[model samples]
Target: MTRIPTLFFATAALFALIGMAWGIQMSASQDHALSPAHGHLNLIGFVAMAVFGGYYALNPLAAASRLAMVHYALTLAAVIVLVPGIVMALRGTGEALAKGGSVLALLSMALFLVAVLRHARGLMR
Candidate 1:
């Protein structure tokens, strides 16, 4: 019921819609050129966010922490940067955004890991 989980879940739903629409558009156009971006959108944007949301839902302690907000922001920023970066890369443009986004995504995951570990330790104690 925490805000973190709700935010994540809502964002995940939005990403799912976008990803599905993109998939359908690609299929109709018979253009699989953006397949990589499509896959990332579904996997990272939808699946990963859903999983993160579920985790926070189950672990309210972590979800309530300040770090949770940081994690969410970083993940969101990564997705924002990454999707466009992938599209640009597909068009043979620069990759700076893609690289930066990838790093931000990794950092977000690392923050989640830390939160998990801390929560687990608290539960054990």
Candidate 2:
């Protein structure tokens, strides 16, 4: 119920909508070239974020922590950077944005790991 979890869930839903739209467009056009981007949007953006939100919802203490905010911000940044980066790469430009976004996404996941390790025990009871 905390803000972090709410944000994650909302973002996840948004990503799901986008991914679905992308998939529909690809299907309609019969051009599956952007399949990778679409996959990432669904898997990382929707699924991963939904899981993160679920975890934070179950562990309110972690959700309430400052680290949760950092994780949320980094995750959001990763999605923002990654989506455009992938688009650019698909357009034959470069992978800089994708790489940077990947790093940020990994850092966000690492932070999530830290939060789990630090607070998961409290939930065990």
Best candidate according to lDDT: 2
Clashing residue pairs, candidate 2? Answer: none
Please provide, for model 1 over 1-125, each residue's C-alpha lDDT reduced to its tens digit, 9 standing for 90 to 100. Answer: 99999999999999999999999999999999999888888877888889999999999999999999888898899899888888888898988888888898899889888988989987787
Report the Cα lDDT for candidate 1.
Answer: 0.90
State the displacement of the C-alpha of residue 64, model 2, in Å, after optimal TM-score superposition: 0.5
Q: List the candidate 1 regions with Cα displacement exceeding 4 Å.
A: none
Query: Residue 35: error of model 1 in Å?
Result: 0.9
- Tens-digit lDDT track for model 2 on 1-125? 88989999999999999999999999999999888878878888999899999999998999999999988888889888887888888989999998998898899899989999999788788
lDDT of each: 0.90, 0.90
- In candidate 2, stretches whose alpha carbon ends up further than 4 angstroms from where it belongs are none
